[model samples]
Target: MHTTQTFRHVSYLWDEAKALELAGNEVDLFIYRSNLLGADLRLTNYAGGNTSVKITETDPLTGQPVEVMWVKGSGGDIGTLTKAGCANLYVDRLKALKNRYRGLEFEDEMVELFNHCLFDPKCAAPSIDTPLHGLLPYKHIDHLHPDALIAIAASKDGETIMKEIWGDQLAWIPWQRPGFDLGLQLEKAVTDNPNLRGIILGGHGLFTWGSTSYESYINTLEVIEQASEYLNANYGKKRAVFGGQKLENTDAETRKARAAELIPTLRGLASSYRRMLGHFTDDARVLEFVNSNDLDKLAPLGTSCPDHFLRTKIRPLVLEPADTLILKSAEELKTYLVEQFEAYRADYAAYYERCKHDNSPAMRDPNPVVILWPQVGMFTFSKDKQTARVASEFYINAINVMKGAEAVSEYVGLPEQEAFDIEYWLLEEAKLQRMPKPKSLSGRIAFVTGGTGGIGKAICEVLLQNGACVVAADRDRLDDVQTELRRQYGKDSTITAAIDVTSTDVIAESLKQSALQFGGVDIVVNCAGLSISKPLADHTEKDWDILQDVLVKGQFLVTQKAVEILRKQKLDGDIVNIASKNALFAGPNNVGYGTAKAAQLHMSRLLAAELGPEKIRVNTVNPDAVLRGSKIWESGWAEGRAKAYGIAMEDLPAHYAKRTLLNEEILPEDIAKAVLVFVDGSLGKSTGNVLNVDGGVAVAFVR
Candidate 1:
């Protein structure tokens, strides 16, 4: 148990006459008031903190007869105070006292006498920690138990815990009572370690001071953030718990056997009270906890912590063997609601009456949390995502904590009324109001092969912009691609892999690496391919094999591996193949290349039909004359093809452009954007469809 003390003192009684007298006598008081007013407006929770400044004065003309030292005034809750709450004391006098006693104990009476001796009788009482502030030689000091810092301090091993998380960038102090003794200890510690940056009082708060007030405050927040991360890593409560009972294999079989007996009642409750009970199905935890040694003895403790109240409620509904029917669960929920909310309603009415200057909705619903049944365990109820998420996180944390606490002692929580007050507090309610709506594909992942190539890179960029984290695979080194991506976006936005898509072994390794890197894959864009423009007579058997390996065989291997991952993870996936417009409209040269590309298109359509029942979408993009700078551009094939067609090298783009009805030069980026449409589910209700991004070239061929 800890003893709490309160300090209350009259610093300066505000009277117009005394104010006028002080205004005339000391110009410093006016300056201090102006500074205090400025700081108060910018800070949100200043009441929980303190600030101090050192003062130095000099002659305006001739620099002579100056007083210089640190002065700290009364400490009080800053939220409910005005400028007059602060005290002004002579810095030199406090320093002289410190020099005399060296390690003297400072009592409240001593602080009071010191303040009285420094200024006129009308001045405010010096703060209880005035002597402590006076002992520090720094120019500015600020202290606060900011919420971020409190979250860290409240954890076990918060000192070593914080140091490991934040490194040696911050200074830490063991917990101590706040007063002259604490001040003396700090002074000794600071003296021993001259390079101290800040002090973290374990299980208490933080302290930071700098050359300026703003710097001190910012530094305090920076240190607190370090502590918060440390706590979050080691002691973060679970976001939700498995509320249903644990089941043995035998018990699971028994539940299935008895399902025929319970199905009718379960179905009725689900149909009639879907809004209240959510979707409930018999799962393993439900069966195990139901068949546990004695659920009645353990279920009352509810979740492990306060956050659980938002989810699992304060307690779970327990059903005994004799009362396994859904009607019994419904009746129990009704009785609990009537008993709990009657008192809750009365208190809410009183609270509203007392604080009714502003008007909002009465409340979304008084019943945000619920327990389902004993055998079924707990279930949360919320009308919106915010309530649901909050409840989920709470229930998760609570369940873990409850289990841990139960091992040591009975699981206990704050009073029900206290929990209600926090749960319904206006400030907390505002937090729910500010939550962003969830995206449709929030948890989905994707992969893009040949990601370093022009078309592949384009697909990857577009996919990332929409929300999916893409794994970009290429045979080249991943360093340049990853660096470029980080420069364009930032680190970890897209992952990179060095892989030869044609090798079955390499494709398998790449998919494994991608899954480990990006959680899982929901989309695969097989953009990797090769082309060689050669007359049929000049084409070699090896050239055909190369084209087949890259264009057809490579895609087969990549898709085969991707499908295995998608099936194992039970993810609905999409595979978009990048075929060429030449596959649809044959040309005089490039026989092998055209044949392989055509085969790839037909294979994609077949895969689409095969994988459709499994909810995996497969499609292909046919693009023509996308002459962007890439591996093909570096090969000098465009110039050779132009010469073979009796056209100038510079005229090659226009020659191809004229073949399209639109006569537009297609770009790799255009094809990439089209690929994005299929990958993002924008081409709704259409898979196995080969969308052409070829500037109307296919239409010209048909005409």
Candidate 2:
């Protein structure tokens, strides 16, 4: 239930919107308000809702008044919307499409008409629902899928309830598949009720309009409040409690741990892509819903609206004997999940055949996007974490909405046929088909050591950009690394852990947790290292022990544990260890660093030989003097190098950059590139090899 305080904490920046309005940028003010509506997860999620504004401008070329509709671009999320996020279209052209769209049903011709209506050829594709806004007369229009309103909209007695509250403030439009026809129907309703402030689409969502963005936004908020207050007062008693206890006795740590154990198995089963990531939630409300007796009955009723079908599927998959899954071995759990996946596929195919019609598109990938298990709570999977996170939030709200609706009356969803239509709607399907293909390393997961350092961070960034989920592990500064990565990629694409490379127990646990959380690891970059440059005769025993612990022993522990998980997944994997150039060409006063790296290099060869039968490739990347962004070089280590070479400290960088035949300044990105070459199998046939990232250093060249 939404408390008053909770609703008060909206993300809307009212002051910013006012400033924009005062500056004569009313379109920007509307965009800002739309972003606020999108940012509030309680109001809408992902790209669920859209907003638009009608502006009058004098055409310079024609010297005539022109009205333009700036609507949200297709596939653009309102949460991150901007001026460019909207598609500009000539209003007259869009309104004229009605004549061309003479058919009763929307088809390729309607799609072509929408494309031709674009004012700018290079503008983003307009939303499928652009016609809905185009036909409306208001200057500002807002559309949202708020859970509170959805609960009321999806109920059988919803229309009666609305009449009892607000008699004719909102015009009622019965359900119709959204397209040219639906927009015309809405326009007729508006004509029929000229005084109406908003329109409620049965089993769909609400549309509010006004002369200003603020008025439209507030109108939507008031409706949500009415729905929320009604549910809390009349349907409060129906709230489900987890395990029949007021609260679960376990703490947060315990819940996540237990959930993590089941994640890998769930991911392996629910995976539709080659590699799918899991976003687990042990949230109190989520746990309560999953553990409640009503879950099986209420959950599969379908989403509150048709728009959600693309991400959450029609329903969430329920796993039984959840208690047994907790105690089962990885292999046993995996086998059971595989069986469940097959059964699910068969069931989905049957449903498709039963509900599909002539205009229906082909069956989409039949895989469960959300899965519910008792002891483990819920796990949502998508192509990436951002998608999964949104799905998780949506389902959580669905549970709340269903509970409220069930209390009001027997909760009923749209019929199976309606669901099939929306899920495979031509407009949505065409947009998806038009999207570019995934990157080369899409759906792959990688675990990198020393992720807070330069080389490690570079590896994480490049991998994320190329479409891999990264688990960045470090001894310290893990939180900082996590924040930076999330900012760069997204919250779901990168996860971080505090791992002491010297501690076997810590390394083992980190690897296991990462594999479970991120599906499984396919590439492991063993890059954690620290070098102590000193004369061999003067180096203390303690210095040598620390070097060996991190470079040689630490590399072995991480790879050994990660490899075990990868092999169990039965997928070919790669292990690329970061060695130093001194490993191949030991320079003066570099004994401790050189010896440890040499050991790491040889160990890679041995591991390659041992794991070759399993198709696990192991290799080494030996980088030299990558000082531009290296923490090791920044910590006065370059001064030591300068002393050893008998040169000025200020001249060290140039000396190293120009020392190589190529005279290029080696960087962390350069080392990361070499690492990927081996991991991506550009050298697919070769293993037990050392690739150098130095700028053609003749002395450091391998024989």
In candidate 2, position 659 carries an lDDT of 88
Quality of model 2 by C-alpha lDDT: 0.79
Give a tens-digit lDDT track for model 2, residues 186-301. Answer: 88988898888888887778888888877777777777777777777765465433224322335667667766556665665566545676688777667777777777777778
lDDT per residue for candidate 1 within 234-296, as digits (tens), equals 332432122323433344334333332332232222222122212222444344444455356
Q: What is the lDDT of residue 281 in candidate 2?
A: 78
Best model number under lDDT: 2
Off by over 4 Å in 2: 1-13, 16-23, 238-249, 329-331, 356-362, 476-480, 512-517, 635-663, 697-703
Candidate 2 residue 275 C-alpha distance from true site, Å: 2.3
Number of the top TM-score candidate: 2
How does each model score on lDDT?
0.57, 0.79
Provide the lDDT at 671 for model 2.
87
Tell me the TM-score of each prediction against the true structure.
Answer: 0.50, 0.91
